[model samples]
Target: MVEPAEFRSYYGRPILKEPAWKQPDVPLYLFLGGAAGASASIAALADVTGRPELARAGRLVASGGSIASVAALIHDLGKPTRFLHMLRVLKPTSPLSVGSWILSPFSGLAAVAAASELSGILPGAGRLAGAAAGLLGPAMCTYTAVLLSDTATPSWHEAYGTLPILFAGSALTSGAGAALLLVPSVETGPVVRAGLIGAAAELAAARHAETGLGLASEPYRTGRAGKLLKAARALTAAGAGLSLVARRNRAAGAAAGVAYLAAGLCTRFGVYAAGVESARDPKYVVVPQRERLRR
Candidate 1:
């Protein structure tokens, strides 16, 4: 068997640099962005299908979630006043810059949709805004993966293709969480099903990221990041399974909904932590890619 490569820290200090952003705001943005985007998609579906009430509710949730996500993103940036600097540069290679561009238009459309819905002042504007909101929603929901993937972190960069899908699934699950918390059982049932499917997909993506990525996935399989990933897998699986039977029991539905939400949060946190770890370990960055090149 080949011996695992050894790594040394820079100057005998820690190899990985600590993440500068606060935990709460970053995770909150992940949750809210997912929720908003999913809600908008659902709302568009409902509208096209002639379910006005469901459409309206979806629109409201999507709009609120998007607005909250934007705020959370700004808060997570240490220099809130300089957040706009992200927009000044159109660097396609920089996930942060790309995300800023995606977010600006999406947030504006969400605002218009929300205001039109609440004020009833714009004739036919609600429909147009809703359409625009729906378009931007998915962009907001999945771009976090790009943001993380663009970084120097080995684990995240290696899992770039899978991250967007995982984030999208998490977004759908979060939208279901909001619906379960706010909507009636009659309406929330389908949302719960949607959430379950999304959760399952997210879990599968994470697993694939871990196993298919080979050594790069070490950060997700060991230490603090590993623990969180394990927890996320367990919670998401349990929640998705339980949601299938939740229609028979209100308590089960509520529990599953809550579990899905928690699982989504955990998944995001774990991914973030894994990135930090991957960045810290030179072995993670150098060995795997080097091996790939050698092959």
Candidate 2:
């Protein structure tokens, strides 16, 4: 029997083009966008339920996160004009274009809602804006994942089916963390419950992706990416466990919130690192293509 063929590229160079997106900035934008989207939803629900403090916290976090996300994206693009130029057209097939539209409107609405909530002006309009932002929250949370998956990155493309769900879960958890840190324990019942659910969903989706991605999952299980993802899993699990006790202890609640937020950050960075690593390895590209051709 003939031996299996060894995958190699000319001069040992990577066959796939690595992503040019700046590090830390892109991942930070992902985290902030997710947090902003989910926080908008939390703010709307809290306002409807008459939880004024929670609503205020959620509104502030949502607005702040959105602004930060914009700054990060613009920074990644190297200038403000580049980001603005993306808004010139609406392309249904382009994740970047669609994401820009979603992000722009959501940022404005979130800022408006937060401003009104803070200044106690135009409460009616603020409520409407907050509700509108909430309506767009889910799309905002998952659009980044779609953008990443739309690329040629092997690990990211292979996990596209589960990436959006993982991102949504992470977003919800991050939003809940912000609320828990700002609002008192007495008014954080919903936030705690949401965080628990988000943590569980994120963990589940990540596991499913790792197991189902086959060879593409290697990046997620090795090197810097592996370390970050492991930390994320541990922190998320610990935070979820702490959430049970957070209902009674403010300190525990704060710790849990921090843990959740940190975990979400780690997850985004881990995913980014994994994609970059995958692109730098010719084996990840060649082996997969060869397998497809063999079938």
Candidate 3:
């Protein structure tokens, strides 16, 4: 059995420290950012294919989501005005740095696309803006995985490959949440279904990766992080299964959407928490890697 004392430091300090970051909001921002980016991409595709309604809705959601995501990110930074300091240099090893650069252009393009649609400005320009916005969407949605994976966090780095898929699923769920909140059940039904599929994919990938990761992965399956991961799995699975039958039921669809969103939030938070836990316990970083090398 895992004991609390086993996770303590030399001074009897809790070996697993809480992240300096606050909870809930940061993960929420990640979800929103992914959704916004994906929605923009989907909307651009619809526009190009002549699905005007889908295109319009996608663009609107994309714009709103992106803006909201940016706001959340800035707010979480504790100094919104100094956010630009993040872009002072380019560092390939740093996911946050790369993300800042990506966000700068992606957000601008998304804003332009949204504005062009609203103002009915230069029809030709709309196509260009839409296309650009759409292209950046997938990248925005999935890059968070890279950000977390680049860290020294054992749980995160050990599950590097799965992180991208997890982030993608979270992004899809965020978009589905927005769709359920804004669109009618009939129209948003497909979005919910898509989110379900994404969530399932995420859960499957995480589970498989976790099992193969050895001791470094233990934190993800134990303690507070473990509890959150279990909850996410349950909620996401239940929500996805229900989404199929809830296609025409507004209340059911709403509930499913909420569940997906919650699952996504829990996943990010759990991963973050697990990382903190792993970092505090030196054995997590040293033991596993050393064992692997000895093999």
The number of the candidate with the highest TM-score is 2
Q: What is the lDDT of residue 223 in candidate 2?
A: 92
Error of 2 at 110 (Å): 0.4
Scored by lDDT, the top model is: 2
Residue-level lDDT of model 1, residues 1-295, one tens digit each, is 9897577766766555656768879878877887788888877776787666667778888878778888998888767677787778788877788888877777777777777777887938877878877877788789888877866678888898989998998888877766665555665666777887788788789888778888888788888878877888887887777777666777777777787778778888888888887887678866776788999
lDDT for 38 in candidate 2 is 95
What's the TM-score of each model vs. the native?
A: 0.88, 0.97, 0.84
List clashing residue pairs in candidate 2. none
Quote the positional error of residue 185 for candidate 2 in Å: 0.8
RMSD of every candidate to native, in Å, equals: 2.7, 1.4, 3.3
How does residue 295 of candidate 3 score in lDDT? 95
Model 2 TM-score is: 0.97
* Tens digits of lDDT, candidate 2, 156-265: 99999989999999999999888878898999999989998899899998887667788999898789998998899998998888888887999999999999999999
> What pairs collide in candidate 1?
16-280
Tens-digit lDDT string for candidate 3 (1-295):
7655343357765544445656666776777788888788777866766667667777788888778878888888878766789878888877888898888788888888888888899867876887898888888988888887777677778888877987787677666665665556556555766777787777886686557678867888889888988898887887777677666677877787678778877877787777788887777866776688999
lDDT of 3 at 169: 76
Q: Lowest lDDT 10-mer window, candidate 1?
A: 179-188
Off by over 4 Å in 1: 1-5, 13-19, 246-248
